[model samples]
Target: MEESDALRAARAVRRSVLGDAYVDGQSADPDPAGREFQDYITSTAWGVWARGGALASRDRSLLVLAMTAALGRMEEFRVHAGSALRAGVTDEEIDELLFQIAAYCGVPAGVAARRVVRAVRAERGEA
Candidate 1:
């Protein structure tokens, strides 16, 4: 696809990933600390993720969700878990990722991630 078309596709997929919270997260009133740094991270992440190389989108997104969940950041993992699905990661893959992380991130963290995965799947009408 053309770059514009690719970007449009990415944006649509991004929107599905973020769900109803997209409006709240995007074009928002800036964060008090600074939105620029967040923008930088966002840009870097997107470029790395959408590069058409590196990791496959589904795997990249799944890794992100797993890493975030391992950190025990429920909300962020919740966001990324949904994003992973939109990136074409399957529910089975997500479940396995969380389960594998249990060995290192702990059972509690894995359980928490599973909860978010379930909720996300339900929201997407896939559960």
Candidate 2:
């Protein structure tokens, strides 16, 4: 299949934010349906990420962290949290964001996000 310019741009944005290693791992061998889904996400979701309008990539990363955490998507939360950190979001900022999440999304969500953040930090040798 020919890749559209949008898909190519989105894939580059995804690699920049999520890291080449992670993107490469995700692109490694998939069944037909899975490959289609991956392409869909790369073109759509990552396309939004690639469009830098009012929000910068770091802002988008932080927003993703909050939204994923509030939705109890811990794995996604962890991924975005790591990306947020790499995008120049401070540990203190993430800590404060957790407090905000606790206040708005409930304490459980905040706690779960903290756990994910801790694991991500540990993985990066930050903890």
Candidate 3:
């Protein structure tokens, strides 16, 4: 099937944020359930919403990390934390955001997010 406009746009934006290797890894041989989910989130969450705003990708990346962290979505927090780093949101910025998260979202959530951020940073050899 030909790619939909949304899918194409999503592919571009997703690549820009997550990088080619990660996106390609997720796109490989997805199960039916996974395919459906990938399609929907790519088309809607990324293609539509992530691309719709005036905020730069860097800003969006930071917001995504913070929101995922506050919700204790560890997998998503890790993914977006990596993306935020790639998008040029510094470790210092993320550290400061963790403090904000602790103030409102609770210390446990901030701690959990910090763990993910650390792992991601380690994976990328960023300290």
| Higher-TM-score candidate of 1 and 3 | 3
lDDT of each: 0.69, 0.86, 0.81
Question: Mind giving the per-residue lDDT tens digits that candidate 1 earns over 9-103?
Answer: 44544555555476346636466445554344444555456556666778778778878887888998887876775678877887778778887
Q: After superposition, how far is residue 80 of candidate 1 from its true place, in Å?
A: 1.3
Q: Tell me the tens digit of each residue's lDDT in model 3 across 31-62.
A: 87777777777887687544566887778777
After superposition, the stretches of candidate 3 with alpha carbons farther than 4 Å from their true spots are 30-33
Candidate 1: worst 10 consecutive residues by lDDT? 1-10
Model 2: pairs clashing at backbone N, Cα or C within 3 Å = none
- Single out the weakest 10-residue window by summed lDDT for candidate 2: 28-37
Task: Please give the lDDT score at residue 103 for candidate 1.
Answer: 78
Candidate 1: regions farther than 4 A off:
1-24, 30-38
TM-scores for all candidates?
A: 0.71, 0.92, 0.87
Name the candidate that leads on TM-score: 2
